[model samples]
Target: MKNYILITLTNALGLYIASLLFPAITLSSIAAVLWAGLLLATISLFLKPLLLLISLPINFITFGLFTLLINAWLIQLSAYLAKGVSIPNFKYALIPAIIIFALNRARLSLIHDKS
Candidate 1:
């Protein structure tokens, strides 16, 4: 339960920051959208990366960038699953997915640096 909340908060923070950077994505309100996005993105956090890995051959076949399209799709799916939240556009969804992915990778490196 605690881990779930933590992941949600992290995702919410990422989405909030992402909205600031991209104009197309708009949250109905910060708190509401944050929590909604957090919940939805938490599910994606667990599922999307594994799916992407499973499709790695095709992703590479399309040139590595196709993974970006997959990430964008997952983000849109999350928004679709979460009520009262809107991605506004695919370009908007792409922004947060990329930001979160890069941030997560950087965070993993930071954690390992301490160990």
Candidate 2:
């Protein structure tokens, strides 16, 4: 769908920007960035919600900071799933995860769904 394509593109842009800003996150090629973006989008769309649902109690207890940890985990998982994208450690992943999350949030806020 159009929305999915748009989201994937937005995610790709986010990854590109994050790589630029963070030396800790590297994209070996454009292809890798695109793959990382696609994997990230898929994981965010499917797995994140399920994990959030299962972690709701802990999320509530942590006053939502646990969601940031989840975001970092998702970023690391995307790195694992996509070749040539490497996040060396959780510390390396945290900032990029925050950046990507912010980028996606801003993109979603600015786009209105016609359907």
Model 1, 1-115: lDDT tens per residue? Answer: 8656655666677677887877666677777666665765676768877888898999889888887777777778877776656788787888887887777677668768999
Candidate 1 clash total?
0
Which pairs of residues collide in candidate 1?
A: none
Error of 2 at 8 (Å): 1.5
Tens digits of per-residue lDDT for model 2, 58-104:
99999998999998899889898899998888887787778877877
The C-alpha RMSD in Å for every predicted model, in order, reads 2.7, 2.1
Candidate 1 vs. truth: CA RMSD? 2.7
What number of clashing residue pairs does each candidate have, in the order they appear? Answer: 0, 0
Model 2 lDDT, residue 41, Cα: 84
Instruction: Compute the lDDT of residue 1 as modeled in candidate 1.
Output: 80
